[model samples]
Target: MVRGKTQMRRIENATSRQVTFSKRRNGLLKKAFELSVLCDAELALIIFSSRGKLYEFSSSSMQATVGRYLRHTRSDQSHHLDQPLPHQHDLQAVQNEAASLLKEIESVEVSKRKLLGESLGTSSYEELQQLEQQLERSLSHIRARKHEVYREQIEQLKEKYDVEEERQQSPTQIQLAEVSPNYGESSSISDVETDLFIGPPKSRSK
Candidate 1:
């Protein structure tokens, strides 16, 4: 199985960072030496540690290599300058597009300001009428929505009132059910049966 590549990043732990720095620094210096010998290539490498220590490798003198690098970088910049720039037509097209976009944005801003009752000096009578009509339509929608909300609130209140009324009347209904079977009978003394005889009279036996 292929081994996973080691992640390339600075180590956070002080001890581990120092250890990794030492190992990588030696490896880099070794690679520079071998490349110079085998490939016979002119090259230079410089490294600085966290302690500000300097380490470097060069196939030739360091000063000569650095000077050559400077010259080559400057020549590249001059070569780029010598090359022809993009066509003027392309540049003009891009400038025209940007100007068109700016004009369109300005027009939209003017329309918005006019709608908000600002910058009305340039607007015509027709434009004012149109803005007024748009505002009326918006107000109509708002009023309709307000009425809908009022109706919904009224319905909610009605439902809550009915529930409360039922709760209050349930106990009265239960009290009616608990009434006595003879509930409507009269309680006055005159309503009772009365008899004048105190004892029973018996006939003589034959």
Candidate 2:
């Protein structure tokens, strides 16, 4: 029967580890070469020993392949180490990038929580006061504009009412002036009729 999965841990024995690395390294390189030859693919492989040894293979020029790898990984060539482990500078850079990404993720999470109304209680009194002030200012501006518009409308209505009143009074004054002369004439004619009815007042008294 095939061996089951082994526990995932670092091998303590140096010799056994070294043997495993060697076997694996050779197998990996052979597979890479075979793939390159069979599929006409460009290939490069890099491996290192635990004792700080450098090993590499490529289907093309090693420099060219390494340059290609550097371009793909966006890693600086100056920081590459000839040893088995990553350089200290590279490790630090990676750590810094990870920390920056973590900070960005945390900021996004906080924004999401705020949007969901989950962090309203966590806001400081100053923040709440500022928000209220902003809201009050906005309302004040809206009310002021509304009042100005209302005042303008009222002034227009008053002007229209004044014009209408002038028109109505002007027609009444014209009618009164036209009737006054006729009224006086009618009164004088009635006085003359009464004198005639008295027979010319007894022929003017001798």
Candidate 3:
């Protein structure tokens, strides 16, 4: 039977305990040495037996390895000491800037909503001024276009009126012949009455 297979707490027999300790210690050291030889890495091992005997190993000089560890610790501490810490004023300034940016974004959103006609409530003086300016510009453009259209319509009506008046004043062929020849003539009296009463078709429509 293998000794490793037999599960027992620390061997009660003193001789067996000593033998096991020696065997395990030699195995541990051998494995450590093998690891150091196989890998080109700095390695250290320190062991103290129950009898207060010391055992140590290093891939390089033990003193040099310890000095290198100490130097690494000192460098880390020095780096931490040299770093600048944030002051209260710096932190407060950053917070204030963040708050101001948030307020500006909110103001822009509110103004956008107001312009889209989603809200119907009181507004600040500045917002009201912006709206008033927009309205004034729009009203000015509308008034200008209305004036142009009114002038065009007025010109067209005036031309129509002039045409109608001229037609009414002009004479018919029978009347023209009568005016030219004033004898006891071929111009019928009924035709003269019609020319007077029925002025012109264009004039009546107007």
Best candidate (score: lDDT): 1
* CA lDDT, every model vs. true structure: 0.88, 0.81, 0.81
Instruction: Write candidate 3's Cα lDDT for 54-133 as tens digits.
Output: 88888888898888989999998898776656686698899999999999999889777876765638887887788879
Clashing pairs in 1: none
lDDT of 1 by residue, 86-142 (tens): 696688889999999999999999878877889888778998999899889989999
Q: How much is the lDDT of residue 40 in candidate 1?
A: 96
lDDT tens per residue, model 2, 1-206? 99989667888999988887888899999999999999999988777787889989989888898788778675544455454455776998999999999999998897567555577687788866765676689789999999999999999999999999888787778898889879988987787544334346566553
Error of 3 at 65 (Å): 1.4
Clashing pairs in 2: none
lDDT of 2: 0.81
Q: Which sections of candidate 3 miss by over 4 Å?
A: 1-12, 73-206
Give the clash count for model 3. 0
